[model samples]
Target: MTQTLRFLEDGLASDQIVALLDLHLREMHAWSPPCSVHAMSVERLRAPDVTFWSAWDSEHLAGCGALKHLDAVHGEVKSMRAHPDYRGKGVGKAILVHLLEQAKARGYSRLSLETGTSDEFAAPRGLYAAHGFEECGPFSDYEPDPFSYFMTRTL
Candidate 1:
């Protein structure tokens, strides 16, 4: 599938984006003890520190992701989701690569992220691992949470 990834300044307003967030929350809540927080609402996603991106395939929203600035040389990945129809088609990886490049271009030397520690998050964790993110202690404002696994990569 041909996909195009782009930086989004105001991308959370779209219905597809809202649907993706909703799906992420639902899947997260299904985990034992519920791993992910019910954050990333449209309002929160539009915050100044957050830079969102959406992947499109012939006008269809295939996936989406975001990066939040933690400091001058660090960033955190957030709200990565691939549409159900596009899973296993490399949409997630493409979006991830795009985000990483954007982060590096912005002068970030490190990237960190928190994801669930449940089966539902296996694919995501694997993706990050393949991208050179090693399991790490919590960074930024996050605290130690059993349901969450933290990872980081130094660019």
Candidate 2:
């Protein structure tokens, strides 16, 4: 099937997005303890400093991600998730690329993210690595934690 994919700049208020965010939060909690979960809530994602994107494939919400401006020269990736039915279909990669481009367009010299360190997150870490993100110390007010894995790449 030839599916049409489009990425929208904002989807925070949509019902489809609400469900996706809920799923992301649930997955995060499932993978780590409460203190280790850094996934943002929908309200937090709607903040002015965050630019959220939702990927749609022929009217289906395939995935979503967000870029949060940490400072004039830095940004952070947040809330990246692919729909259960869309895993391994490049939806997550598409969202990540979109967020990276957005960060670059805003003149961010560095991009960073915090993800879980468990086996469930290995695939995501690999994806980040493939995109040139390397292991790094915590950034943007994040404290070092055993359950959290930090990664960053210079733009």
Candidate of highest TM-score: 2
The global C-alpha lDDT for each of the candidates, from Candidate 1 onward, is 0.83, 0.90
For candidate 1, write residues 41-135 as lDDT tens digits: 66788899898887778778888888899899999998888899999999888888988998999999999998888787899999999999999
Alpha-carbon RMSD to native, per candidate:
1.8, 1.5
Error of 2 at 81 (Å): 0.6
Please give, for residues 28-139, the per-residue lDDT of candidate 2 as tens digits. Answer: 9998999999999998998998989888888888989899889999999999999888999988788888888888999999999999999999999999999999999999
Worst 10 residues of 2 by lDDT: 1-10
Off by over 4 Å in 2: 1-3
Worst 10 residues of 1 by lDDT: 2-11
